[model samples]
Target: MLIIFIICILALNPIAATENSSDWKTQKVENVNFKLAPQYENGELVNSKYYTIKNMFIFSIRYIDSDSFLKSSYGDDASSEDTHYIKNKNIKGHNSSIIYQERNIDGVKYNTTYIYFPIKDEIYCISYNGSNITQDIEEMIKNTPKQTMSEKKFYSKLTHATVSYEYSQREENSYNDYYYRTPYQYNNQNKNQWGKYYLAYSLGRSSRYYY
Candidate 1:
């Protein structure tokens, strides 16, 4: 009887934990509506919303005007060779552009996935940095309600300033020979700088120093 009771408790614990971990809640930014697991850390920056899960995976949504939409709809021009397109197809009734990026940071390989689509005058970019969460992130993008943004423009200089500050800090921490290195070296020097440029260029201003 004791053994049977222990086995029953073990089986029930997993079911309970699974239920709790899968508790997804709906969230809205502007007119777009998407779902996120209850256990998440989220923040906002200018025209962007960022969410972090399990302290490893990061997801973000940025709203940009038509011009920036067209430019980023196909990924960046100065992207590193480590980045490439995965697919461009319809996912859950929405035409989405997806890309895969890999970088070697301090001997550890990091992977990121990005999805972009346009809704009305604004383009929505959904990106995740980490592993084993592609399916969940895609579902979040697919489940998002496609709604038109208002006519009021949503550009922010603060986003550019913040990115610039972050870039400077990254440079300070990078190796001394960073500037003298090859393009690939520079790209690896600051993998996060790519996303910073995304935010900068989205604001219609190009960064003087780019990787």
Candidate 2:
């Protein structure tokens, strides 16, 4: 009986697929191809630059030194904005542009801004694999935002999406967010199919850094 019930659930998994209205989109930033733009690679003060790949502006600036901004991909804790958005709560996650609700920075309330960067007036960030060796990218991963599959879309299976603002702590900043589309499966027999994946994903939080 239990096996039959489980089978029925899996068969109806697609029906229970929780789709976010803002989940995946077919649109994408154009004209720019983000190339890490590592400071160590360029030797400090990477200098902001605009690329035609995504038409977004990108910069690779160094730490303020006096202030503790731009620590690591996720190791930053000095920004008042962080605490302002979360407000006495622990940061659940972060990325190029996937900010949270509220956090405090410098005793002032602020939004926990995501890593998404800014261009001439846009935002950009990069995301790679999510199920390979790990879930989320920490300061240990390539100095880039390693978003889970949930945060990304493939160019093939997307309809439409728009971008807002792009931001970064670097000088040679260029692109920020990418709106692509990927394959999406609907299986009723997999209600909690991705639950484990997501749980592990949420747990694979990014690391924080301080300069």
Candidate 3:
């Protein structure tokens, strides 16, 4: 029953994006096998790689420890508008607050969600980009297997599509669902600059894992 309003994100064209032969590669972290898609460079594992969904959004996922992540992201900065804490009612059995951060990089706005929790004796963090903390995202964190790595992808197919107020009355549920049903691309006529240029490279990629 967790729901949040997800605003329209700027879209991009997907090029040089690779698809996995299978799904995710299995790696054991903290005594749990984690399914991951570590970018392979010349057959060797790389730390991070960019994922581009045609006409949607581009994002990257990396593996790092909780302490390093916190220190690197925020160094001795007090709480403010850019950084805030939110309580999630959907995540059960965990006593941690979800930290939300908003950043503007090169005039492009980015939203990040951070969750810190322990797997057995070791603490770990999972983060991702989205306009808001939707219920689906919280459930993804809540159900991650202890000691095992879990992978999730949210994406879409339409390159020219934009979800706007004019088309908001569609009956489909979930943001992903909305994209799945709405295939008409947005025409910039009479639209504002933001609306005309909105793009999300991470649409229609939900519950998918790759190797």
Best by lDDT: 1
Q: Comparing candidate 1 with candidate 2, which one achieves the higher TM-score? A: 1
**Global fold similarity of model 1 (TM-score):** 0.46
In candidate 1, what are the lDDT values of residues 76-111, reduced to their tens digit? 411447675455556565555566777776797768
Ranking the candidates on TM-score from highest down gives 1, 3, 2
lDDT of 3 by residue, 69-121 (tens): 43433221113367665543324444333567677768987676655443443
Candidate 2: tens digits of C-alpha lDDT, residues 1-211: 9999999888776432122212312121253323332221222222342222211111222212111122333223223243233211111232223323254446854332233333222334322212121222222123223334232331111111211111233322422211222223234324455565566567784322110
- The ten-residue window of minimal lDDT in model 2 covers 156-165
Candidate 1, residue 159: Cα displacement in angstroms equals 25
lDDT winner between 1 and 2, please give it. 1
Name the runs in model 2 displaced over 4 angstroms. Answer: 6-8, 11-25, 31-78, 81-211
Instruction: State every prediction's TM-score relative to the real structure.
Output: 0.46, 0.20, 0.37
Better of 1 and 3 by lDDT: 1
